[model samples]
Target: MASKYPRRQFLGQLAALGAAVTTVPQYARAMESTLFAPAGEKSFVPVMITPFTSDLKIDYKGLSALTDLYLASGAKGLFANCLSSEMYYLSDEERLELVKHVVKHVNHKVSVVATGSFGNNLTAQAEFAKKMHQTGVDGVILITSHFASREESDDVMMTNIDKFLALTEGIPLGTYECPSPYKRILTPATFKHLIDSKRFIYHKDTTLDQAKIKVKLDLCRGTGLQFYDAHAPNGVFSLQNGAKGLSCIAGNLYPEIFSWLCENVNNPARSADVSWIQEEITRLDDVIGNGYSLNARYVLNKRGLNLQVVNRASKSPLTAEQIKISDDVYKTVLQWHERLGIKV
Candidate 1:
């Protein structure tokens, strides 16, 4: 007899292993050796922010501290060199170095995946992905916009992805519907095509539509692919519907809360708590993204992460109104910790 909870069972085996990261090629010994919570057991994977010094340089010290903070807050994996990290502002060399630094600092405690597709063409993107893979990340994520422009059709995007796969054969890859350039959400048919390819092991979904999310999750039923929804409002819905975990910008603010939500979203005993957190998550979603990673950095600093509010992506500093809003949200976050007995 088969289990009624098909998705759970499909992911359960890897969850039992506790730290099974992405299923990469045998040659990727670094990733293979790293530990990550499988899709069955939900985990938080933060779209990590880049910490900069007063001089606008990549602050390695702050970066290390930020890395430690995420792990301490229960992040099971790290999505470095991403939009949250201001990847577009960083040079190619900076991107690779940033990812390499994160991989070295993580020391295989958990898997790390970074954006590698920054080139203008499929071949350049493939070459960059290969180099990023060499940096010991478990997976290299390709930005969807980098494949095809907004003017292009899904078929054009698919063909380019196929070419990319061929060019960077044998490497573990993932896809990010990055909001930059443009957000090219994959249709169900296109999603099935990627699933059929079996080359992608992760997807950071920005589709934000619950119905679409459900369809995508259905496609991931028994595949090695794990879908991570980036929308904060869909936290409970996505988790309950079979998403592996979250990869939202909100995690950059309260990773512990996100991690807590993931661990308990499916707990029958905590169903009410789950619902309440979902409400809170939905309510604060806009406020959190107002000033974005900068607002997040401010909150993190108040929480004792000691990060400077410096940012290259959103060069403008937070407005007084934004700061006031973030401060209010920060107070609410503390209240949540106290109310739910989550660690401060």
Candidate 2:
């Protein structure tokens, strides 16, 4: 025989279950909080730097001109000292000088973000973040540790964030999560801890797994993390999955394509017109041998940017046949762009 329960007890149990179920949306909202635009805020679309060589050195003049093009093209922001810019190859002084150049050229027309990912030195990275803040740049983009073990990588990330937040006090920071076997993926719990701290203002979700990406979104909900999709090939799908914008290498060679996608993402009538554009961009990635960073540089060269396609200064170099393949792919993409009336 079951014991009799009062109506109040039944109601209390119902309320608890309802609260648990209702928390899902609340959690999602919390995770997504950081990504929201401020009141009356306009959308921002960021373009990456395409490091070009002039006389076998970094081309400051060409860099300035390219930045001016993006500004004139109505880009909302620019990122300096990134993989596209070959930041890893640059010395500390070169990186600082490049940031100064980027800020000077943009001339406050748009936000300028600089990469601050130094290898395995939280103190150095934090100090760099502080300097970038002092330089009056808008933000800093940081990568987690360079450890091969996941546990070690996680420890480095947690420690780095603590130090970075303490050092960079008032400035916004964007963390780039590009998963490699050497680095740890920021788990949902760790992401929540960071987001809840209210120190990190943006995140670039470059992890390839759709499920993991969703988890990122859910974990960061309500934390005011402006999430950007770094995987250029899936920009549209990423936007659909709650990413506020994109920060990508493909944006270097094909700003118009990304510009169109961002503009038409919310407009149903215009979406089909741009879906083809997205598809073409994705196809271009495949044609150039996907996942090779040099592909973007090659595409830019083919577009007559006069940028060198050399990635020798990078962490790795592409083979001669790889370069030929990249160039051939860019030509094909250009022909497709012409056919589609997409002006480069």
Candidate 3:
């Protein structure tokens, strides 16, 4: 069945096939510029920020110090104004200020990913995304519209995403899939379509469903989009499944611990070490994470991080009983921290 063609021409055809195999979409090329280092280059472990102060103002000094601490602790990057960062309670100006400060503090030690989600307003969120890119940040994390059951909400989210991509030019983008706070879920098909659009280069999977996580991982394969587990309590298993990295609020308090767990998770010889850390972290989560309440913050403060225990002034303060319970939990975590050789 071999046809008589010149050997040189046949070789050229094979080369062309190789090039075609490697080619990526133009938009994806642009997105990849800021996405995690080209796939297989290096995996990144990012810490989500939790900015708070007693006066309800953005803690500029504390934020700067924390940013420095995380980078020094071997974190690969920072995600500002995310769920852990309490983005909902912040004003537009305060959000921008936090992004700017984190950018300045990080000073290129690691990439900065800023959250651009706001209440169902695509235009405004796009504007913020554009500004974030202009400030030299690497990426924006967009949350789908909250609590909207309408088909129109999906349309709005898609349109807004398109607008944001167009406006940011070459900035990378990430999507945060947090089902608890947002009533609507982005189905597997819809998620694949978005990734196919080449606008987003990452997905922060906060949904704890193993089945859904597998779907996202399958759909994102070969697209060069990175997936991270925001559900830290389940992160070890998530990484084993397919997550490229970990991004969690727990990283705010135990940056080095999370960083070590991530590095060890990838090395077969270190599985035992990672298992020990994961077990301790899971125990802490059992006591503090159930309510998503004050216990986590109090534990952070007790360890000398000075994070405000209150969620947000705009939201109701933690009840007295909740505060007392949180304090008890904080003491217990501190004891464990010392036992584990984690610095307070």
Candidate 4:
């Protein structure tokens, strides 16, 4: 028999995983009063969707148009060529061109980063990262080392990271626990090594386990490494627990909601307000996504940007079932947005 709590996993209630309580951190409140407060707004960096023409080539103009929409819609940061962008299907040249284009188009309007590393060849990967850094992005993030076997020793993973880091020269680095080919949730020891490097500056923790997330957030504090929990359900709870910001796929559709959470994380008075917003976010995700990329395209279409959801690596154009969900969820989110008085 299936579990009754369909939404529990999505909402971060995975108590079986030994997750601890996620609460507001006093350190975050105190940081605001200090001079060395982390620069940049606590913002959501949407893993942006890639637009495709009828023939599947990059829609350069369409991409620029999307940038305008994101900037206007309250996105303070943009993540490019991530799994959300179908990085697996894109060629190296295409990824570089896409990043360069986004950097120029965004033009310092917000922080920009991309998943620059792809395969196991650390030399080429580092070269690509170096090039991406020159494109004016704030950082280059490596997808977690999924190439290694599950039985692969921690030392091998650490050595791979060290090799990759040595080659990335002047680029600021971050890691995304992207469960793509597979997910390798970083051990606390690996996270500590990153903090000690003084070079790895951001982490998109994907474990979604509240206890471990708290541990990661605590480790990141004052070390200048920003920990952004990638799982949406934990977003609000994690924010209150000293997470520096949020980076999630859901931001592609609902940046305004995430941006609001980041800004108001410290206000205990908004507890009721934030809880409702977060619930809406997760509930909408439950209905609107099998994976966010295609769903995002449909919503963008519903919002009036037309593009084919033509993806070679996965489902494209969405299923009939998904489109039905899209219609219902779209209407619901609009109503919720109005009720919440949200602008985007």
Candidate 5:
């Protein structure tokens, strides 16, 4: 179903969000208990992609439609304005507007988190995070790269992270090892630091290595932080070994498959089906990365969203072969929907 909140209500909420920036602690605490995910529950949180108009403006109508599709497809939450949303390419104001739109359109029906730490310094990051918190997001996600340089030691990163934590005070936080600006795969020690902070409620892991994932999961076993694997091929393994759920690029195309995998992967009776679907996801995952967000747009359009295949992150247009691959993958998703009895 579409958002019950109409355009008028959304604009009102956006204005409220702007004014509420001054009262962050009170508003954030009011929603924290309901917004934060409890430990041990599985989720499919799509790293949302921003849709653009032909003239390169934000296509808000398309964004709202996409959000509704995710909700209908069984997404447990939303990760908005992140790398998948082309955050780097978006202006700071545009990022806030995009997130506010999603949060209002979602009407607090599900948890929402957006990347907020964007400045060159920790103070700037904290200030922006507070502003983002006012947008009614469940939490503000900090990029791992923002805390440390590629050549810097973990200690340097920790020092910076500690400072940022102190600066932000009451705002809830999460971390993402975003691929751009170089991916900072968190070491177990660094991961432990975040868990121990009692501030981080989310962690999106990109270290496709399952052994490392297992160790980190053990560390965060009882911690409230929800660990999500960004690698789609490891979806089954990560979920089986106790990661909260998937937060991968593939969700941008067919979130229903991820939602179904999260719901049924642990069932003994569904083991065979699980294995088959995992293989399918792994193969399609590889294909989806070729043209990336553009190919993803193609698949979504094929599914009837009719989004303009425009992205600020990459100017590379999808090749003919890439479009063919996307078509095949769309058919595969349809087949999964039929076999799994997933209603579209």
Candidate 6:
């Protein structure tokens, strides 16, 4: 089959995603979520950041602007109240309102989902998930099961997921491998069972390892569960192996590039071209992992967007060294975008 993606027009900005695409097995080429949106919908979904005023107030104005920015730029969906939004730090009221605001503002122009389960116990998590569903989000995402010890077993998690399913009726469910308090990389067997169980329809994968990602994608191959790649370093590789979409934090910054990559993973075009483009994305991903919120604010400011007011418990201003590094990367990123003819 030939790729509908025009070779020269798209993926012209980034450095080199070519080598990375070659890592994709010739056999592992899937781009659609079997049970979700039809072909040509947005696949690069960004876990949105909560914009705040300098005084630490929820910046509704900023949120509105950011929301508009994402929609105008061709985002197929919006995910809110996730770790990228700093879910652990937000109060119940804030989380609910923010998800509501994003869903309502997006106005069904795109799919919407949010992480409603905070540090609350499983029962409370379920209740809150239902409330979030009432806010009109397409799905309510749950935090990864936390264990005081990382030695917890799949059997134990299976029992817990059952309880979550019992509580969250009527509303759809998703899971995130959020690493804040603790992170659980669901075992391949457990993930296959989760997909077979018919309760979970979404997964935010953080394994960050291509080998493991391949196993998970294999599990959900014929199911409706859409696996989103959370880790950025191997993002393009995962896409080739049939990750339904990308839930990368970088999407908020450069959605056009993300969308272009997502649009062409299964392209019948030159594999070298695809691999080089993926390498460039991984390069940007390297720059992003340095710092999450602060780095984003710095770039957003450079792009004439808003600054963040909320701070992590140990948050401090980005050091001069950090600022210079981010600015240099930012400059290169902007140049790349210009070369691709993407409107900022």
TM-score of each: 0.90, 0.76, 0.76, 0.85, 0.90, 0.84
Error of 5 at 100 (Å): 0.4
Better of 1 and 4 by lDDT: 1
Per-residue accuracy of model 3 over 1-344 as CA lDDT, tens digit each: 11111110000111234644864443455443534433443244554555567766677777776676677667776777676666665676777777888777767766677766553344655666767665656667776543233456566666666766666655567777655344345778768768877767667776778788888888877775778887777778877777778887666555666766666686877777678777887776655554453455555556566666665623666667767767776665566556555563
Candidate 4 pairs with clashing backbones: none
**Model 6: per-residue lDDT, tens digit, 187-225?**
888787777666666799989878888989898876767
- Deviation from native of the Cα of residue 269 in model 3, angstroms: 2.3
Clash pairs for candidate 3: none
- TM-score between model 2 and native: 0.76
RMSD of 5: 6.6
Instruction: Give the TM-score (vs. native) of candidate 5.
Output: 0.90
List model 2 lDDT by residue over 57-89, tens digit each. 667877776787676544666767765665655
Q: Note the clash tally of each candidate.
A: 1, 14, 0, 0, 0, 13
What lDDT would candidate 4 get against the real structure?
A: 0.71
Supply the TM-score for candidate 4.
0.85
Candidate 2 has its poorest 10 consecutive residues by lDDT at 2-11
Assess each prediction's global lDDT (C-alpha) against the native.
0.83, 0.61, 0.63, 0.71, 0.83, 0.69
Give the Å error, residue 248, model 4.
1.6
Superposing all C-alpha atoms, what RMSD in Å does each candidate have to the true structure?
A: 8.4, 14.4, 12.2, 11.4, 6.6, 12.3
Candidate 5 residue runs with Cα over 4 Å from true position: 1-40
Regions of model 4 farther than 4 Å from truth: 1-40
As a whole number from 0 to 100, the lDDT of residue 340 in candidate 4 is 61
